[model samples]
Target: MLTSLWQRLRADFAMLLAFLGFAALSFVFLKLASEVLEGETMTLDRWIITGLRSADPTVPIGPSWFETMMLDVTAMGGVWGLTLITLFVTGFLIVARKYATAGFVALSVIGGALLGTGLKALFDRPRPDLVPHLVEVSNASFPSGHAMNSAVVFLTLGALLASTHRSRRVRIYLISVAVGLTLAVGFSRVYLGVHWPSDVVAGWCIGAAWAILCWITARLLQRTHQIEQPGAVPVEEEGGPP
Candidate 1:
């Protein structure tokens, strides 16, 4: 068992290395760190420009709509919503899926969410100041919390749903829906002027990396444990064999 545990940890390390490698490719947006910040500033500037240049009174969904949407999303991405989502996911995993798998899913999401929060806090980026504020917030704003949380939760849950099915189409559908939601929420941040493009992109990259790391770690651990199927272990005779 000790040997197996070491092997599991080693395997997990290797898998994590591989995940980082892949993430390096899929999440190359890190190179754009400065550029991303610049773009965000520009995007926020656009919001201000649009407001200043607003010549039509008929456009209801202009700056005001965007502001409302951003604040609303911020609220939706709050701890309450996150807690509810977590509970629902954990319950589903416990009831419908294997406990180990469920544990992995929950851990990955929570870890990813925390990571996003950390990044936001460390960066200490401010939201766009180009437009008049509709609602007030007091957190660093680079990546949108809603985008990060949605990405983690949706992708993790979708992966779980996909893994249970043998049908490729079903898997694709689940993945598609997950991707769609992730994109929608991320895009909404930009559209609403609450986050810069770079912020959302970074959120996506980090969130994805966190999820992949969790999955690979879980897989490696499972391999180490080497679970046996029901009755696969031979039963010893009670009174016959010495």
Candidate 2:
């Protein structure tokens, strides 16, 4: 009985933490949005953008190879790259017979992309023009799509994959990689002069909140057997084991 009670307590604590994280992120995004609209972040944005460049705004303050590497890192957060990743992970989950989890991941990524797009259109903010962009970009950039989508995809995948594991260290490692990738992508946007610092920050906030929301949903669904539990055995077909 004590063991069962401890499990319940842990679950409750996790849910509480998720809710708090979601709320905090949402508040930050909203606050940043208002400040951005008021032009309150323009000075800081310009300063950071210029700080990353040399006297020549076109030249990023880094080795040529480093700039090339940033381009590659930023590409990982692009639509095509993220889509391929989502498909690959989804395929793996389906092959493992975790059909519901696969569907959930697909929907979460798609939904996040749509959400980011809608916000960009709604804000209608212009891209940073203080420095020449190192990469091609054509979009309203209040919240960076690359940063947001990367967070949505990477963090969601990390959380779900971590749940499937039993080792605490493995779970921590997976989550750390996700966060690191998200941060790298966001920073790359600013370094490339394609997005303002505020834009990346806003993206991180909204993306993280959405990921947390999805995680909470997954937990609720798991409780009702609507989705496969972590480490659940594959269900056999009527005919028997394959």
TM-score against truth, every candidate = 0.69, 0.97
* Model 1 residue pairs with clashes: none
Best by TM-score: 2
Kindly provide the TM-score of model 2 when superposed on the true structure, using C-alpha atoms.
0.97
lDDT scores in order: 0.63, 0.94
User: 137 in model 2: Cα distance from truth in Å?
Assistant: 0.7
RMSD of 2: 1.4
- lDDT by residue (tens digit), candidate 2, 1-242: 99999998998999999999999999999999999999999999999999999999899998999999999999999999899999999999999899999999999999999999999999999999898998999999989999999999999999887776678999899999999999999999999999999999999999999999999998898889988887897867777776
CA RMSD of all predictions: 7.9, 1.4
Candidate 2 positional error at 146, Å = 0.6
Q: Tell me the lDDT of model 1 at 138.
A: 67
The reply for model 2, stretches above 4 Å from the true place, is: 236-242
